[model samples]
Target: MKLGILGGTFNPVHTAHLRIAEEVRERCGLDRILFVPAATPPHKELAGAIPFADRYAMVAAAIADNPDFVATDLENRRAGKSYSVHTLELLHEEYPQDTFYFIIGMDSYRSLGIWKDFPRLFELANLVVAARPGIPCKDPLALLPVVIRDQFCYHESAHMLRHRSGNIVVFFEETYLDISSTQIRRLVSEGRSIRYLLPTAVEHYIYRHGLYHNDERF
Candidate 1:
């Protein structure tokens, strides 16, 4: 089985999120894409994120229509700061026979070395990075220590992750929706419309819960 792991805060699920999942599923021949919401990211702290339950609910609702896309609270359910390596380890254990491909943004991929047990993460599963339009592999190998640089290759697309080992695969897709949870909160706080920024259900949930009204950090 081939599983695609899309992990993020998902303070509010958006259409672009779904689009990326669909693209990966079809292009990468993935059997399933699990959307795992982060509990507390190691690099940054969430400021105005809606309650974890609410974020999880919105994610579930947004991906409910797609059988291939499912939401998992593995990171949120676990204690302490959420680390990719730990999550990958747990996922590997749960789906022993499945090939796990981690789907993430190119920005995250560039910072892989900064992550905890970065090399172990690659050993556990392939890393699939979704690069924004026109963004080159932002992280240069020259910046990394010699040993870690040797572990990765400047390759594009999920196919590289599937076919190659010891490297991160990047998939550059066109996504015009440059929206973020922080931006969404700002728009909502200013009484602006967020019709296309997120799913209708998620918008409704945010407004109904009065989230991000006073804070727009997350």
Candidate 2:
């Protein structure tokens, strides 16, 4: 089976997160899409980050109705700071027969080189980069640094980069809702309506836990 991995902080999983996964699965011909919430993200600010348990719960609640979607605790099951490369490596080892696709946004694609063991990540799975508003949707190879770009070659027929190591970067154009976890958190803090931004179950979960209340970074 082809697996699509969509990893994120998911401080609160929102509609866009679900939509992107759905689109990517359909476009990439993936049999399953796993939403892996990071236990401790390495690059982003975690000042007001929610606890791992709460974040994981929200992901589970958001994707509950979709049979094809799964909320995984892969990162939460591990110790220490989370790194994508390591996660992908373990996944490849465990599911040797599966073709894995690591999903990311265009913004993440631009900073791919700086990631820990980034070259090895490409070797483990194909990258499915979804375009978001304000982030350009272009040849992903061009966005990589010169050194990283040297490893990829655009296959005009495939419309994806065929890496020297047999890895491929699939640049997928998708219709994404302009919603963010940051914006939802800010609204909740301001006592504003967060309707339609995320699943109703997730909204209720946030309120019950008093999450992002005033954005105090507690």
The candidate that wins on TM-score is 2
Top candidate when judged by lDDT against the true structure: 2
lDDT of 2 at 109: 86
Q: Give the count of colliding residue pairs in each prediction.
A: 1, 0
RMSD of each: 2.9, 1.8
User: Which residue pairs show backbone clashes in model 2?
Assistant: none
Off by over 4 Å in 1: 138-145, 152-170, 216-218
Q: Flag regions of model 2 displaced more than 4 Å.
A: 133-139
Candidate 1: residue pairs that collide: 157-170
Candidate 1 lDDT score at position 57: 91
Worst 10 contiguous positions by lDDT, candidate 2 = 132-141
Clashes counted in candidate 2 amount to: 0
For 160-213, candidate 1 gives per-residue lDDT tens digits of 432236435545564646777777877887888989888887888888888777
- Per-model TM-score, in order, reads 0.87, 0.93
